[model samples]
Target chain A: MITCDMAVSIDGYVAGPNQRADAPFGDGVGDSLHQWMFEAAEENAAEIAAITDAGAFVMGRNMFGPGRGEWDLDWTGWWGPEPPYHAPVFVLTHHERSPVQMEGGTTFHFVTGGIEEAVTRARAAAGERDVSIAGGAATVNQALAAGLVDELRLHVAPVLLGQGERLFDGVGRTELTPAGVRQTALVTHLRYTLSRTAG
Target chain B: MITCDMAVSIDGYVAGPNQRADAPFGDGVGDSLHQWMFEAAEENAAEIAAITDAGAFVMGRNMFGPGRGEWDLDWTGWWGPEPPYHAPVFVLTHHERSPVQMEGGTTFHFVTGGIEEAVTRARAAAGERDVSIAGGAATVNQALAAGLVDELRLHVAPVLLGQGERLFDGVGRTELTPAGVRQTALVTHLRYTLSRTAG
Candidate 1:
């Protein structure tokens, strides 16, 4: 299944303002958005495991690093040398770069073609396993607009960012059926099955 | 206690495009948003009853009618001589008009001052009973921004409008705890208790 998982604020913002080199989430706002992942690790163990369990992952350039234009060779990613995805990870970007092989079988393949190309490559790499769309909002919106996603899981945080990058800013209209719903004090896990035939 | 209730699309839009003289919800979009009220009345009886059971109600001018600038003296409201609001209903408007008394003890008191004034008048008329903030999106956002609403009940429709009047457009940051949640095939009823102390 082509699944996309994201943690969003009540207002549908995936990340807060001023996304830069030092402050990725801006004003330490992103930290509060993912408190459910760490603070209630035991309770959300299944969800945490579901996020990185895919055989291959596709993410936008912004998710890889804070740099723009030229590729910053020094900055690998937010995750250390080993990273989390123990499989092939495709990074969608305008600028092309050679694949970076990290420790623990994770290789970052920069795809300049577009979202479709990245997903195609991820699917090829994934084989029988699912191609997970690890997002930063824009990439997910692109995927949804293209009707590439099969399942969409949203970790809805109770907090509101007020202003930032919204998940469904330019997504237009997409049909989804509520497959399942689970709630915690910090976040509500809503699972949606995307209608391939409907828009 | 003060309460705010609204039926919104999955994308948070309360109303759709091209709101005109004939189509109040903009091109028959409002019908799908409130299918639970009509189609499944028996199941949602409590929710339907809760909406108009208030002693007094407050609404924006937009909810009263589609007229802008000056009030069409003849235009009482979309509702006939006898409106759903059986009690005193305060309408927030810039163009002040004399209170229009309707059948079944319903009176439309046009409050020119602001949301606070409308609430105040509604509160006075309500006596010990709760005051309801009947919405058209803007009014509810204003009430939420001003920290006037004590409880928020959202009738979340499964459909997606894509673009329209959003409920949390410019309400800034507000804290709310999920008080109650109920779901039907048509809609999901989410009740939130506004934390006036937190923002």
Candidate 2:
């Protein structure tokens, strides 16, 4: 089973122009949706490190860089000196690139084969633990539509962009079953068990 | 002082089709983003009532309406019989209509003279309590741009809406200061004090 954990803006934007190419999650306000992740970093570290529940992570290339923006040679790691993901991370991209290594036992592997292929590798790397699909937007939707996700936890922010990007922008009718919910210190976490149930 | 409270889709859209006169909360699932507000109705009723130190509410006509697409004439009072908003509410619209009095001291008044005029009327009616502009998008932007809103407490949802009516579409550049942040059982409340800080 794969679970996708993401933090977003009230308006649905993950990160804005203010975000840095090197440290994508820069010192900006608002979109600090994932600040909870950082806050719970150590607490969840046991669960994350044990790999008893989850294994590898999958992300899109766009999330790594800013899509078509100019490249910054030194702008590889989004997280600071110690990136959070302590396991193997497979990023889907078009342009071939070398895998980058960072602190906290995390490595960025750029995969171009396909999403399924990347998932396959991720599962293999994950071993007994589940594979987590951590992403920006396009990647998650693709996995969701392909029925590749088992669990999805979403934190609905209280902000409204009134514009920007959308995740379910172009999807047909779908129904989600709520598995459980968690009210964090700064988030309303809604965990859903996705299934192709025709209601 | 006036404040706008809203829940919009990750696509920047507030309501979908507008034809579904019955439920104008945006796309079908878009209404999912409103789970907290609805739940807050049940759990936080006493708390909301206690802290609702506001004079009246200001919403767009679209929020109150005859809906957009199918005109089934279903008045959408998502908040149940006795609305939580016991105070008077002013709806912004171009058409004229009679006022509606409902349970729990809620009176729905329609205003057409424009946002400023509506604010003037609401502020005068509010006395000491703040004027809350609970909206559907266009209304919030209007009040924010007009420099009439004194505070904005946005509940950023976790969903991403690729498109829809955005809250900050043309808000331009305005300075706002985040005054406080609090987390409840279902939402992360960010209270921002709006100010014309820079001249």
DockQ, every prediction:
0.48, 0.16
What are the per-residue Cα lDDT tens digits for candidate 1 across A62-94? 989997798987778899999999999999988
lDDT for model 2: 0.63
CA lDDT, every model vs. true structure? 0.85, 0.63
TM-score of 2: 0.66
Model 1 chain B: ten consecutive residues of lowest lDDT: B190-199
Best prediction by lDDT:
1
Chain A TM-score of each candidate structure, as shown: 0.96, 0.77
Error of 2 at B175 (Å): 8.1
The residue ranges of model 2 lying beyond 4 angstroms of the native Cα positions read A17-54, A65-84, A95-108, A151-168, A171-199, B1-13, B20-23, B26-41, B47-54, B67-87, B95-109, B145-147, B150-199
